[model samples]
Every structure is written in C-alpha cells, then in structure tokens.
Target: MSEMHELFLTCPKGLEGLLADEAGVLGLAEVRQSTSAIRGRASLETAYRLCLWSRLANRVLLVVSRFAMGNADELYQGVHAVDWADHLAPSGTLAVEFSGHGSGIDNTHFGALKVKDAIVDRLRSASGERPSIDKLNPDLRVHLRLDRGQAVLSLDLSGHSLHQRGYRLQQGAAPLKENLAAAILVRAGWPRIAAEGGALADPMCGVGTFLIEAAMMAADIAPNLARERWGFSAWLGHVPALWRKLHSEAQQRAEAGLTRPPLWIRGYEADPRLIQPARNNIERAGLSAWVKVYQGEVATFEPRPDQNQKGLVVCNPPYGQRLGDEASLLYLYQNLGERLRQGCLNWQAAVFTAAPDLGKRMGIRSHKQYAFWNGALACKLLLIDVVPTQFVTGERTERSHAHEHSDTGQGTAGEHPPAPAPAAPARLSEGGQMFYNRLQKNHRQLAKWARREQVECYRVYDADMPEYAVAVDLYRYWVHVQEYAAPRSIDPEKAQARLFDALAAIPQALGVDPRHVVVKRRERQGGTRQYERQGREGRFLEVSEGGVRLLVNLGDYLDTGLFLDHRPLRLRLQQEAAGKRFLNLFCYTGTATVHAAKGGARSSTSVDLSHTYLDWARRNLSLNGFSDKHRLEQGDGLAWLEENRETFDLIFVDPPTFSNSKRMEGVFDVQRDHVRLIDLAMARLAEGGVLYFSNNFRRFVLDASLLQRYQVEEISASTRPMDFARNDKIHRAWRITAR
Candidate 1:
C-alpha cells in the first residue's frame, strides 16, 4: 500500500462545505471541514488529481511534518528535522510563508525568517552550498503554521493558487475571481442543467469568467490543463509518468466530450471594450466551439436556442459600493427583470449581488437565498424560478379589471359575471392604515388642482400628522419622501417602526410603483452640506413647470433641483419677464432662469458658487432652447453682485438662511446680510426696475432699515402656492423697487 499524505485545501469563505464534498468525491479519505478550508488524507495520485480538477480551491497544501513547539527555537528544530534534499537540490531556490502567531513568534515575517534559517543550515551542512530565497517562481515553496502550541510544516503543491486558471489576461474594472465564479456556477446547479441538455446565458458577463467556467464544466475539461508550471514541477519527488497518464486521460475525455452534442452557451456585455477581451478569453479556453460572446445591453439581452429548451440565466450584477451607485442601478435591475420575463420564460436564474435590497426592485420573487462573500463584502445569491406565479405584479385596480372584461364582452347582462379583482395586497397594521388613509385624502384633494394648472410636480403631504413626520412629494410618476429626524425624547425603535409603516403604505396610496419611490433622511445641514451629494447616482429627470422644461435630481442631493414651494414665484417671474433683461441670484438648478427665458426675457444671467449646479443650469437652459443669450457664473453670489456693472430690468434674489461654503470668503446670514444684499442689487437696477427678494428661514426677520431706504411691499401671501398654504412659514418674500 502507498503511504497517505495529509492535505489541506483552502477556498473562499463560505465555500468550505462545498470543498469538503468535492474532496470526498475525488477519493480523499476522512474529510473534515473548517473555516475556508478542507482537511483530509489522500494518496499521491489523488492529491495530484485534486490540484488539477478542483474548481473551488484556492491552494492545495501537503503536510510534510508536524510537532509540538513551545518557542521559536523549537519551531526551527521541527522544520530542520525534515530532509530538505529530498524535495529540492542544495543550489535551488525556495520560499517560506508563515501564518498564525504563538510561542514567542508574534510576527509572521520573523517566524518565516527563522524557518528559512533552519532550512538553509540543514542543507548547507549536508552539501557545500545552500539554497537562496526566491519569492516568485521558487523551486520549492514551504508553509509553516503555528497553532495551539504546535507547528505544522507543509509544501505548497498548488504554487500560485489554483484559482488562476491562466485564461484571463485582460479583465474588466471589477472582475470576479475565477474560483468564486466557479462556486457560483456550481451552486446555481449548472452541472445538472448541462447534463439535461439545457442552455446557459449571462446578460452582464464581464470578461466572460462565468461563461468560461460553465463551458469547462460542460465539456469535461480539467480546469488547469493548460498551465505551464506548478509548485511540484521542479520537486524531486514529482512522478512524471503518473502526471502524464492523468493529463492524457483528461485530454481524451475532453476530446470525447467535444465530439458529443455541444451545449448552447452565450454571454452578453454592455461595454464594447470588454467584448473582444471576453472573446479572446473564451477562445483561449479552447471552448469557442461551444461558447460565444457579443457586445449587447441587458435591456436587449435574449437567449436564442432550439425551441422548447430551458436553461439557467446566471449573472453577477453590479450592486454598487459607493453611496449613489444603488440609485442608478435600480433601473438596471428592473430592466434585466423585464427582459427576463419577456424573453426567457420558465428559465432558472441565479443573481449574485452585494446589495440585496436592490434585488427587491426587480419585481420578482426569489425562492431561495444563499450567503457568500465577495472579498470582504458579504453578498447573497438569489435563486429564482422565472414563472408567471412569481412575478410581483402590483395590486390590480378594479378599473383595469373592468377594462379587460369589457374587451371580451364577458360582463354583459345575462352573461358570465366578470372575474373577481386580484387578491388584495398584504394587510397594513392599524397605524399604517391610518397613514394610508391620510395620504389618499391628500392626493385626492390636491391632484385635481394640480392637473387643472398643468402642474406635474407638487407636494402631496407634509408632516400632516406629528407621529409620521415625513414629507411626500409627487414628481410626475415618481414619489420622493423625506423623513424628519425624531426628537431625542422618542424611542428610536418606535420611530423606525412608524417609518416602515409609512413606507409600506406610500405605493398603494399614490398608485405609483414602489420602485419609483426615493427616501432620504432630512436633518439640519450646515456649511455647503445641502449642496454636498447624498448619493453618486448622477441620474437626472426632466420635469416641466409653467412652460419651461427643467431638470431635477432626487437621488443625489438633500434638496431636489426644483423647490415645490417656489412654483408660484417662478410662474410670476414668467408672467412679468417679457422683453426685459433678467438677473437671478443663488439660482439652484437654473429653474428660475429657464422660466424667465421662457417668458421671453431678452437675456439672463445666473450666478451661484457651485460648478455642479451651474452645469445643471446650463442643461436646463439648453433643454428650453435658450442657451446662447444666457450667462452662467461660478462665484459667490455676493462677490458676483459686487463685480457686476451691468443693469437689469428684473432681478430675483433667493439666498440660503446661512452659508459657510468653502468657496465663499465669509459666512452669510440672511437676516444680517439682507440690507447689504439689497443695496448691491439696487445699484444694478435700471430705472423703474423691480427686484424680488426671498428666504426660507423659520425665524428670519428682515432688517427694519430696508423699508426706510427703499419702497418695499411684502408679497408673502400672494407668492405662496396652494400646496404650501398649510405651512404659512415655508418662505417669506418681498417686492422692492426704488423709492
């Protein structure tokens, strides 16, 4: 009988169980599983086979010696006991890796140094020369592990990690590691599906890792068949004849598998740059006959195979690591789900993502979920059976049912009664029901007024009830909710429960898709914090107010691009701006400038400190076909006004209550700076010109001296819109002209 060698197979976290099962299937004996590794005893042939065939292992280590050690000296003695001449020539190069810390060896580098000294001393005593250190491409690689007062010395047989299958040389920005991709395919049941003659597809294939792994499994090819060098390649104990026999067998099996019917496999990537690289990788794997890749988008992805063929749709969609990434990716996930439903009916799907909440927006139900780790970030694998029964079609309204039955004449007199409406959505709690009723009532009352005025965006509800302190606004078909921070006296858990209830009722009450809703926490912002981005999603939506089209970004900033309460003010500007030179100060998103231009203003100048908002303003003006005559300046409002020498017939000044933006020279307070701000604008006003001043500070008091210097009339009531009437203190406005 041949001697058995102890082996340890390391894999990615959460893949230990799968690795252990794979070891057993490979003829390893007495398999035991630990965190991210599998341990067992195997013959030399079995160990070699595992190194070639393991699709989930990172490295394969073969134990050479084990002994108890109390200190670093004892550790050196244990490694020295091994006959180094049997593994490598005295003049060959070697590398040592040490893990764990104990028995006076607290640093891994120090422990590795001690082991290296021991090995060199033993080999030098036997021969006249000693081996030198080689960190890369060493003739022999040794590993020492110190655990629980014992040391285990092993030889790294797999060398440069088994995950490096050597096919992918060019990769995308964030490519999945090869072994992790293989584990995902295995967990998705690709082996079983392939045996049943089914197809496979990846809609977002980056560099074709999943496609190549799936093709290798379906074609019965060894994962590492093309590798040139291994850790055991230079070892003296390597059995060349046995390895050639196994390699020849693997080659023949691959030939036979290729001769059989080829399974349909395809990959589609949205990035044009990655298409050629993915194709190159697939060709390098020698599976181009069975697999193909193309440059396509997820929105248009469809698997084309023989009729009546069902398969697995596997993809690792980007879940976003930065703040605003999830918001932009929401629509991507939705589009993927829509395509899957329309194109690949009855297909199985496995979607792996780091952001599980975004998965819910796909409008599908996942039957099972498995946890995995992508590097250090925890992720989930959502297993789904794509069928009609699992689609999340929102609650059906009675009107839709009536329209459907009318088309078939099924509800006519004496005919079969119309089918009952779809089942009601899950019941809301008592508090949730109350919140839902309030939202419905508010929407019913405000919707008609909004439509009559051609208003597509307005506030529907605003902290009407103290317990649910949130503001809900309607932006065409989408809803934006801002939750006010609870006071310190309130229980945090209770407040969170109330927030959940409010969120649950919003979609049903407004008749909008839940995915269209965006929520953010509202709190007091200092400095330029309000202008600071809350998310990285640069997605912007174009909305119309008055007669001009403007852009609004609800996901990026604390305040949407357009303020709902300023609708009336913007309309007034449009009504009075014809043929007049206009100047707008502190113009956010340039919505006001767009309105003035639409009102036939001869030309306009808009100024603000943020380059981002200025760019947004440019887009808004361009959207309204008024860009050539407008000027956008990026500087402090006060400084810009001081530098301007031109006169304007109409001016609007809306300053923040308090601003300490880094771009500005000094802090600005609305109450303290009002007098100086009006003076600066009054100097630039043409004869008979008008200036409108406004601010939204709850406790603001206009300087009394302003009334003495100029003829000012308060228009707070007339400028306030109906939606903002409930909050009389939303903003204070005044119309001032020269005395």
Candidate 2:
C-alpha cells in the first residue's frame, strides 16, 4: 500500500453528501462525493480513524489497483499484477466480493472465481502454497468493482459494513438500518441541534434506533468503539500499538462527554414489548443514562417541561404502501401534525416516509425535502419548521368547508355561524335553535381532543338534548345522524317538528355542508336486519382510526362499516399481532383482521356467515395489500371453530347479541350460548395465545362455571375508545387465556 492511498467510503444512496462531509471533518484529503460512495485520500492512520468514527459510512476501502480489462484473461492479469505478499500471506484465509461486470466477465460469481484463481496462482508462485478460502470470516477481505471494461480492486478495511455499530442485539419490524438512521440524523442536523443545547425526540421510536443514534452523536462517542473485531484486526500489516493509542484517546473523550449534562433526549412507543428492547440497545451502546424511553401513545407524547426547547423531532412513522394502508394513515399523519403544532412549537420536525403525499395531509407544509432509499424502497425526509405560520386551524381544513350549507335542502345556516341574536326563521324553529346550540357546544368540546387523537369519525352528540332524540357522528367532512324512534304517546305532529328542527340545526351548528350529511332512524336490529340496505346513494366515504382506513356507508346501511366503540380494541390487536397467527371469528366487515395484519401478523383468517360482509372483508383486506396472506371464510363462527384443525396464536370472537339466520344450524343467542362461544374460540387458541370474546348484549351474563378452566379478565374499559366513554354498556369484552 502507498503512503497516501485513494479510499472509497460506501453508504446508502442519497447520503453521499453527509458521508463526504464526515470524511472531510475527519481530516481526509481531497474528498469527493458521488451518488452512493465518497472517495478521498487517506493514510493508514486516516483510514483507521474513519473506520472508528464515520457513522454514515458502510465500509472503508483502500484501492490497491485499477486496470482496463475486456475479458477474463485480462482481469486475471490485472489482479495477478498486485504484490500478494504485502496484503495477504500465502497461508492466510481470504474472501472476495466481485461487483459490476463488463467486457466478457458478465457474471459476478464467475468474475469472483477468476479473481480468486489469479490471487492464489500468484501467491503459490511466491511462497509455494496458496492461501485458503473462508467466505464467512476471512483473515483478509477483498472487493473488486468492474465498470465499463475497467476494474478497481481494493482491500475491505472495516470488515462487514461499518453500519453494524455493534450495539443492536434485537430489532422490530422494518427497522431502519443503523447507518441509514445515522444519515437521517445528519440530514436533520442533530449535531448542530445538540451543539446549541437543544433536545431531540422521536414520538414513534421503534426499538430506539433514532434515539440511540442521536445520543451517540450528541455524546461524541465513536461509532465502532464497542466492536470487538474488525477486518484489519487480523490483517498482517496492522499496527497494534497505533490502534491501541487511538482507542485510548476515544475512551477518554467519551468519558469526558458523559460527564456533561446529559442531552435532553427521550422516545415514546405505543408498543410495550419494544420498550425493554430499546432500553437494552441503549445500555449496550453505553448510553442508558443519556436516553430514556416510555410506553405511551403519540396522542399523549410530550416533551418534559424541564427539557431544552428548539430541538429537532425526528421519526420514521409507519408508511402504508399496501392496498388498504394509505387510507388508514391519513389520521395518523393528521394526529402527528396536531401534536407537533400544539406541543413542539418552534422545534424543527423531520419525518421520514415512503409516501410524501401522506405528509402533505398533515396540513403543515414541509419547507424542505431530501430524497433517500430504504434499501430499494424510495423515500423522503421531510423538514418542517413548526412555527405559528404553519399551524393548521380548523377553518382551513376540508371538514369546515363540507358544512358550509345544510345538505337537507332546507334553508339552513351556511359554513360560518350567523350573528348571535338573529330572528328565528321558520326552518330553524325554537326547538331547532336549542339542538344547534347543543351540537356547537359538543363540537367545541371534542374537536381539539379528537384531532389530537386522529379521530375523524366519532360520536359528537349522543342524545345530548332530549328534544333532539338523536345520535350524531362526525365522519371527516360528513355528518351521520340517527334519530331515535319517537314514543307513541307524543303527538305525531310535534315529534315530526322536533326531527325536522334537529336535522336543520345540525348543518348550522356543525358548519358542515348539508349535502354531505346522512340521516337515519334508529331501530331495533336482529339477525340480518342491520346489514340491510337503507338508501341508494352508492357513496362510500373513507375515515381513519388507529392508522387504518375503513369504508363507511351511511346511505347504504343503517349501521356504517365501522363500530366506533371498538377502536381501542382494534389498536391493541394491531400492537400484539406481530408474528402471530390471528383468527377473527364473527369478523363483521373484517376491520379487526385488517388491524391485526397491519400489526405484522404472519397470517390472518376472518370468519363470518354473511357472504355480503365476507366480500366486504375481502375489500378491506385488499385495500391494505393483505388479501393474499389473509383469508375471508364464509361460515358460521361456532361451526367453523368446531371443525377447524388449525390452532391460532391469537383469536378474537365478537358475536352478535342474537342471530337466528338460516345459515346457522340453530339460533345463536349470546345470552343463551355465551359459554359455548367462549369455549369454541378458546379451543383454537395456541399455547401462550389469547382469545378476546365480546358481545353487545348489554345485560348478558357469563357462565362462570363453564369458563373457570381458563384465565379471564374483562377488558371492556380498556377496549373502549375515548369517544365511547359516555356509554360503557355499548359492548362487553374479555381476554381469555388457557391456564
């Protein structure tokens, strides 16, 4: 090797500039950047320093030879010309990585074999015995890049990609590679943020990649300090004394860095299973004291009051690229925007996502964007300065414009409310005025909280006014109103007047367009009556909950596609679904199955008797790109469980209160067959698996003696969403596990 060798530092695409900048900072000479590699001039010491310090570099390569070649013979001659004795001993083990091809060497394997033969032939001539080949862990690693009839051979100094930082013991779903995580931090300007005494946060921190990387950068810890082995460590030319001196200096610097006030860094995760792993990774990185993680939802995540202000909030939130994934992400992005706008004012925010379109839905326009690649998937890093100017107010959103005029065709109020005291019109009678006031009050009370939670479809008014006698739900830009049937004792004309007043007042009070609102009369439903069609509007509006998009049809059926009360339960299933074989029994519309699939379930089976709903379930699964791994079976839940031979890691059973459908062998009433239903579902549960059984019978009682063999806990309180807090009797749920 020459005194000053030409070296190349490879990194993920779109991170070339940061890698080059890091090389220049490390005092490498003549730094030049490309799409995925950075080239610079470096001595042996410079190369060693970068291997230990460059967080964005994948591997450090020291160029040995470059020659023009058009065929296998020329390639062999070129590699054979280098002095094999200086870099590798004849008795040592070696491996070669051949990439790119030109001339006659069109195959990587063939090219690698040719190069290996040439190296061995040359070494045999010099020492009389060739070196052995060890692909897994060789004493020396060589890389040969062939481009346009030219080949450049180099020695792999860092051994495995430098991105392996030697700390991560375990990882969660679709984890960001360590080097890419560091590159994201560099692009987000974390070093400068730390220098300015500003804190850092990741609301969706999974496995603490971002948090640990940020902490390491802030504390000036060497990226590869903890690595016990390196490619050069076994190389014959390595200088042990020099490496030991440099390693000692790094240790002293880290010790000094640790004494400074720890950076105000924290992370929050919705999945509890990931919290301990995050702490483990942090401890392995020797940064446990500087970083902290907690179990919490994004809706409630906030920076500590004592923490520094004006920092950077970086996160790689779930980017749904599958069929049904996009629709559900709308609310998550919306909620994220709200959290940043409300809590992190003045803090710079960086969100890395594969779907830039979804980022726009956050309502906070990104000031800058940098393209990147997470493996082969193209993505972007969006930067937004969370200042007052970018805040999204209620009036500026689509929901407000939707309510400009009442869709009822009656002359009602427009988008904005009228002056405080105007003459009551015939359309809005005295009773209508009261209903309007009540809706307006509810909207004011729930809108902010709902927005914070990314809840677009929620019950805004649940019979708040006795005269109204209706339940009102806001679904994005549309309103769904279900009026309770008036009692027979009341005068018919008076009841009709009150219903008209309530309908007219909704648009005026909610500021939603009257045309988007759908009205239905609440009635008792049994068997298949609830699924029956009510109108022919043929409109399917999309709303989001727990990062899943659901199709709701207020015009087609009395009940919309979603059961709003189960939002919390669906989210919980999403959290616990990873790597599990999930079974959804009585899966109405298969919304819960979609949640489980999105949560990383290996496979899902949704069983429902209604072919119409089974088809609906298929659509929901198809919407999320989970149609293939999941199945929608049209069969009776109990019968299917009794005949099934497969055991599930997780099972959910949510049966109707009463069903006398002809598809069933007999009437299946929850109150009469509760024990049988639980046992059937539990029978399919695998070891360590759980069965979530639920029904909305309101007064249903469990057969305690029958279920005594299983461990059961009623989770109705935790399963209820914030919107359903007013009515706990909406449903009953229990988590049952085999003893």
Each model's lDDT comes to 0.84, 0.81
Write the residue-wise lDDT of candidate 2 on 1-739 in tens digits: 6489899889999899888988998878999887689998988888889999999899999899999998999999999999988888888889999999779988999999999999998888543778999987898999999978889899999998898987888888889999999998888889899998888989888899999999988998998988877888888778888788888898888888889999888887777788788889999998989988876656455664453467889999897543223223544565577677767888999999987866765657788899999999999999999988875443222223334333322121112211122111123456666787788888898899898988888888887667678888988888887877777887866765676666656766777655455777776767777767666666787777788777877777878888888888888899999999999999989999999999999999999988878888888887877877898888988899889989999998889888888888988888888888787887788999988888888898888775669998989998887766778788999989998
What TM-score fits each model?
A: 0.78, 0.58
Q: What's model 1's lDDT at 235?
A: 85
Candidate 2 segments exceeding 4 Å error: 125-128, 396-739
- For candidate 1, give the lDDT: 0.84
Clashes of each: 1, 16
lDDT of 2: 0.81
Task: Give the Cα error of residue 717 in candidate 2, in Å.
Answer: 42
